[model samples]
Target: MEYRKLKDQDQDGDTNEEDVESLRGKAISGVSLKPLAAFGVSSSDRSKWKRKTIVTFALTILTSSQAILIVWSKRAGKYEYSVTTANFMVETLKCALSLAALARIWKTEGVTEDNRLSTTLNEVIVYPIPAFLYLIKNLLQYYIFAYVNAPGYQILKNLNIISTGVLYRIILKRELSEIQWAAFVLLCAGCTTAQLNSNSDRVLETPVQGWIMAIVMALLSGFAGVYTEAIMKKRPSRNINVQNFWLYIFGMIFNAIAIVIQDFDAVANKGFFHGYSLITTLMILNHALSGIAVSMVMKYADNIVKVYSTSVAMLLTAVVSVFLFRFHLSLAFFLGSTVVSVSVYLHSIGKPRR
Candidate 1:
C-alpha cells in the first residue's frame, strides 16, 4: 500500500521497476570496485595484472644481470676498449636501436605532421639535460673505480637514496613521512655496513679522491633519477620509444664529444672500435639494454624502487665477487646484509598513517 501510494505521488517518475530491482540486488550483494579503482587497478581484468607482474620480474632480472656484467667485464684483463670509448659504443648502439624502433612505431601508428615541429623542439630542449647527466655519472664511475674498490664504490653510491628522497620532496613537492625518512637512513646505513672492506691494503690503496667522486656521483644520480621520474609523470602518455629515441640521440652525441675531447685524433687515427673485441660489443649491448630497462622502471614506478633494485644488484655483485671474483667476505658483510634485508622489509610493509 505504501509503495503504491509513493509511486502514485510521483506521476512522471522515470525510474522503472527493473532499475530498482537491479540496484537493490547490487546493494545486497555489496558489489563494489571503488577501492581497486582508486589504485588505478581494474578488478574485472586478471590478464592485464598478470602481464604487469611478468614485466616487473623481467626488469628485476635485467637490472641484476647488468650490474654483474659491468663488474665482470671491466675487471677482466682481455677487454681492449677503453672505458669511455666503450661507453661511447654503448650509447651509439642504444640510440640507433631506439631510433629504429621509433621509426617502426611512427610508421604503424601514423604521425601527426602538425605536431612534428613541436615534438622535435621539445626533444631538443629537454632531452639533453638527462643525457648529459648520464655522461657525467658514467665518467664519475670510471674515476671512482680508479680510486676505490668495487665494494667502496657500491657503499658510497648507495647514498643516492638519501639524496633522491630529499630531492623527491623538493622537486615533486611530495613530502615524505618521518617513518619513510627513517627507513631511507636505515637502508643507507645497512648497505654501507654490508659492503665495508676488512682488508687494510685495499682500503689504503683507494685514495680520498675516489671517495669524494663517489659522493658527488651519488648526489648527481639522485637528481637525475628524480628528474627522470618527473619527466615520465608529466607526460604519462608519451611514447616510450619516441622519448627514448630523443634521449639516446643526445646521449650518443654527448658521449661522442667526450671521446673526441679526451683524444682529439683517435677518431681519425684508429677509429671508434680501436682494440675492440666481441666482449666489448656484448658489454656495450648489455649496458644499452640496462638504460632502457631503468627508464622503464622510472616511468612505471619511482626512484625508490630503482634504489632497491640497485641494492639487490649490489648484493648479487657481492656474492659473485665472493665466489668468482675471489674477494673476501667480512663479518660486516653478513651483518650489513641482515640490516639491509630488514630495511627492505620495513620499506615494503610500512604504510603512511592518515
Candidate 2:
C-alpha cells in the first residue's frame, strides 16, 4: 500500500492497514460492511477498542506494580543501587525484548522488506529525539525529588496531561470538543486533589527550582509522547515491534551515555548487580515492561489513552499502598478518584468538533 493511502485510512479511524485491506477485500467480494454499522459498531471500531483496552489495561497494571515495587525496594530512605545504572539496564532489557519479539515475527511470517531489520536513516532518526527527551526527564525526576515531597511531585506531574493534550491537538491537527478540553482540566485537577494532604506542609514548601524542573519535565514528557505517536502513525503498515526496536535502540544508547556520565565509577566499583535483590529485579522488569507497554499504547491507541491509563494507575497504586504499607487514604483521595473516573468517561465519549 502507498504511504498516502495508509495515512488517509488511519485518519479515517482504521487501526491497522491490514484490517482495512481485509475489509476492502471482503467488500470487493460483495460482503457489505455497512450492515455492521446498523448495530452502531463497525469491525474496525471494535478492533481499535479491543487493542486500546488490552494495552491500556496492561499499562495500568505494570505502572501500579512498578510504583509498589520501587517503594518496597528502597533501603532506609533511598535505593542502595545506582538508579542511573538500573535505568540503563532497563533500556537494554527493553531493547532485547523488542528484538526477541521481532525475531519471532520474522520466523513466523518470513522476513520481507516490511519486516526486515534494514531501514533508511530517515526512518530511524526521529526516534532519538524522544529518547533524549526522556533521558533528561528521567534525570530531572531524581533532582526534583530532592526539593519536593512525593505528594508535591504527583501534583506537579499531572500537568503533563494538559501539555500532552495541547501537543496532540497542535501536532496531529485533531480538534477536540469543548467537553474533552474540560475533561483534560478535570483530570489534572483530580490528580492534584488526590495527592493533596491537608495535614502535611511538605507540598507547600517546594522551592522555585523544583517547580521549574517539574514544569520542564512535564513539557518534555508531553512532547515526547505526542512525537512518538506521530511517528508510529506515520506508517500505519509498519510492524510495531520493528518500530519499538528502533525506539529502544536509541533509548539504550541515551541511557548508557547517562550512566557513563553519572554513575560510571560507582558501577565499576560495586558492579551492576551490587544492590539487586528479588524485589529490585522485579522492579527492573516492571520498568522495562512498562516502556514496552507505552509503545504498544502509542501504536494501538494514542497519547490521550496513555494519560488516562496512568491516571487510573496512580489511584490504584494508592489503594494498594493503603493495604501493603498501611498508608492513609483521605477523603480528598476518594473525591479526587471519583472526579478522575468521571473525567475519563467524559473524554472517552467526547466527540471531536467539526
For candidate 1, lDDT tens digit of each residue in 82-195? 555665666666667656655555576666542121375654577677666766776666567677766555456666778887887888886556766777788888888776
- Per-residue lDDT tens digits for candidate 2, residues 1-354, read 111111111111111111222333444456444665688997778556556666778778977786676556543244467766666677677778767767776777889877787789999888788777776676676688799875567567777889898988998887889889999899998988887787446766788888788778878878888888888888888887777778777766876787789878988999977776676577667777777777777888888888888889889999999999988999999999999999998997897755
True-vs-predicted CA distance for residue 168, candidate 2, Å: 1.2
Q: Global lDDT of each model?
A: 0.60, 0.72
